[model samples]
Target: MAKHHYKVGQTVSGITKGYTSEGLGILYTEDNSRFFVKGLIDGEEAEAKITYVGQRSSYAKLTKLITKSDKRIQPKCPVSTACGGCQFQHIAYDEQLKIKRGIVENAFRTIAKSDHPVDECVASPMPYYYRNKMQIPLGLDKKGNIISGFYRARTHIIIPTPECVIENERSNGIIATIRALMKSMRIPPYDEDKRSGVIRHILIRTSYYTPGLMVVLITNADNFYSRNNFVKALTKAHPEITTVVQNVNKRKTSVILGKRFRTLYGPGFIEDDILGIRFKISPQSFFQINPLQTENLYKIAIEKAEINNSHTVLDAYCGIGTISLIAARHAKKVIGVEINSRAIRDARSNANRNNIDNVEFYTADASDFMENEAKLGSKYDVVIMDPPRKGSDEKFLNAVLTLEPKKVVYVSCNPGTLARDITLLNKKYEIKSITPVDMFSQTYHVETVVLIERK
Candidate 1:
């Protein structure tokens, strides 16, 4: 490989041209070589020190800002730069929407090779303090005292934060109370290196539509000494806490939750309403973290689906039947499929609680279920899919193609993978409309809903 033009610790000055999908500012040198600078925005002239040199591009840290962009604003969180949670916190909210829309449009143009016009990104109702869920890792600081907060950018080092701007206010309080109690009780944080200690993580989930909260303590072992007192103290401190659970995760892994759960107080789950449908949310249920944005996203998705009483809908990768139960209200019948059986159980319970008789759920892989349905000559008028960040795979897209649904509404979190899947599906379906939703405000991640029609 050719020698890199920029060396580490060398200072370079340039005007930022654009922002990358990861929210880094891009600046080009005279030779057209690019450097991605963090904590910088587009159209800003800045001096930065090279942090790392790559084959094609270099990474830099912004040192001095000569000219700031009009969209640049002060971030609300004190540790926004180090927390790695919200990448676009410095940008104005309106500019954030524009950037996210550009991200979707660029993905389609570059990955899908389509020049389709994308709608403006729908902004979240609450830009900050919108997240209903929070998972804080427990670790020890240099003083060997208990520290509970988020990990730093791309590393396991904990950044102690008493409050996070994006998390629900109640969740923050819960975290603070837990940290205080852990300190009072002398509960040591789990040592990943030594593989000793007790608490590993603390997960808090707050209800958006109701006055309910679920606190899950993920520990390295099942034994939580003085567990009842812990629950009593937590509930006494925070009356909003409706449920408390202890998840035993003994494995030496990065995953937070475990297979076994023990409920110490109230029911094992909390209930929340989304689009007038009450959902029983357990610690492991895959509900959307941003409830308000989720409502808007689902509304747009259902509108684009154009479901009617005569329509039969297939909701693939349905998590707890959020989309399927919502679609069942308008469609004649809805079938929801997911790989996690626990979510399927919750879906069934949610449907029963809502008294929706037309929806059915299956515990199977989405693609596998679709392939079996195709073999059985199953038919449906509409298909709705809300895939994870990686988006749907080719096998899943092929299975969706085989079903020959008249309309397909794809909900995607990753624009690149969505564009790739759309390119493959475009061979059979015609792209109708694409709408991006700002589910995660102050972050680079954006959710998109696409409508496609049989060609």
Candidate 2:
């Protein structure tokens, strides 16, 4: 084994490995040195390069495919590897589901060391057109053409996206219109260094529960020449566009949109009905992108909790009260708590617009609220937590355990953290059901809902 450079021709009989947070891992080599490999799959053998030397493990790169895994497939996107948006697009959807489910299982078994049985993977119903929202970045390509797409995987550089196959047809149409309008107006693109441009990005969202479309233009300033022109063309081209708004992100940052906004067209909001409940989405509020699937997800949570008119429910991390509103119809009282003040305002307004009198909104950190509730000996018959990708923290999880609710519905985007947190609560709670819903298709992300009963 030479130390300076590795011959790409050299072959190593090693199994392709799985990954955790950092990167893929290989089985320990002879002499007990772990090899950290990249651009390879689990249960595969390939010729690799010793890219870098490390204390505990050596980093290697795949040069030749020695053995191919059954899970591998040709990625659909030409720039899949370069673009960071979709992680498992190369793998077949079925294979991707298997790998994701295994990750969830291992997180519980190996990391958390729990005895709960991880169920089979539940795949997405519609792999394409599952995305109702898309935020297209605006920049200039190498050819000096204005580009609008997602950022390349892990870089600040933008990848101009002309066509996105995974989003709804209307979204793709809007993107095309934006591109054509830019070409027509010849609006100069935003320069990251100089911080000057007419447009920054375009956020397109559609509602499965409503017939209307929402288009929000995120720009650096209120330069209304091209934006006004674009809006005219967009609404004229697509009658589905019921609401169009402009978001002013004057601050110097890569964030697409800011809080300050102005309505360009329609009533400042789009109405959507879910589970016999109506919701009005404001520009800044948070709502599930995949509306149809979210209906099922909320239905599952509401059904499993056995919510009744006599039960008092507390919904933590409730964005715009999507769940709390649905739960309100069945529960005696529902309190939706969130840290975003804007979201809280939207939640309250949504409840008011829907004429829901039982549901209330609270602006506070979720974990802090749970801890304080525990200290006050306050108990809720039902508690629903739909945390972000990180899942619930230890303080919140422990506080929830002490509350001893009749049923706890945990909705999570990241299964690894959900499994880990479930293991910690296994001492006081029994795993009743684990249902995985595919909110994001053509992507590796999964939305899992778990029900726990106090033992």
Q: Specify the highest-lDDT model's number.
A: 1
lDDT of 1 at 227: 75
Candidate 1 colliding pairs: none
**Residue 326 error, candidate 2, Å:** 2.0
For each predicted model, how many residue pairs clash, with residues at least 3 apart or on different chains? 0, 2
- After superposition, the stretches of candidate 1 with alpha carbons farther than 4 Å from their true spots are 1-3
TM-scores of all predicted structures: 0.98, 0.88
Tell me the spans in candidate 2 whose CA falls farther than 4 Å from its real position. 1-13, 19-41, 50-62, 423-427
Report how far off residue 292 is in candidate 1 (Å): 1.2
The weakest ten consecutive residues by lDDT in model 2 span 1-10
Candidate 2: lDDT of 254?
A: 63
Q: Model 1 — which ten-residue stretch has the worst lDDT?
A: 1-10
TM-score of 1: 0.98
How would you encode candidate 1's per-residue C-alpha lDDT over 1-455 as one tens digit per residue? Answer: 11365688998888788778777888765566678998787789888888888886678888999998999998898898899788988999999999899899989999989888999999899999999999999998898777888888888899999889999988888887887898888777799999998889999999999998999999988886777888899999999899999999999788888899999899989999999999999999999989998999999999999999999999999999999999999999999999999999999999999999999899998888888888888899999998888888877788778888999999999999899899999878999998999999999999999999999
Backbone clashes counted, model 1: 0
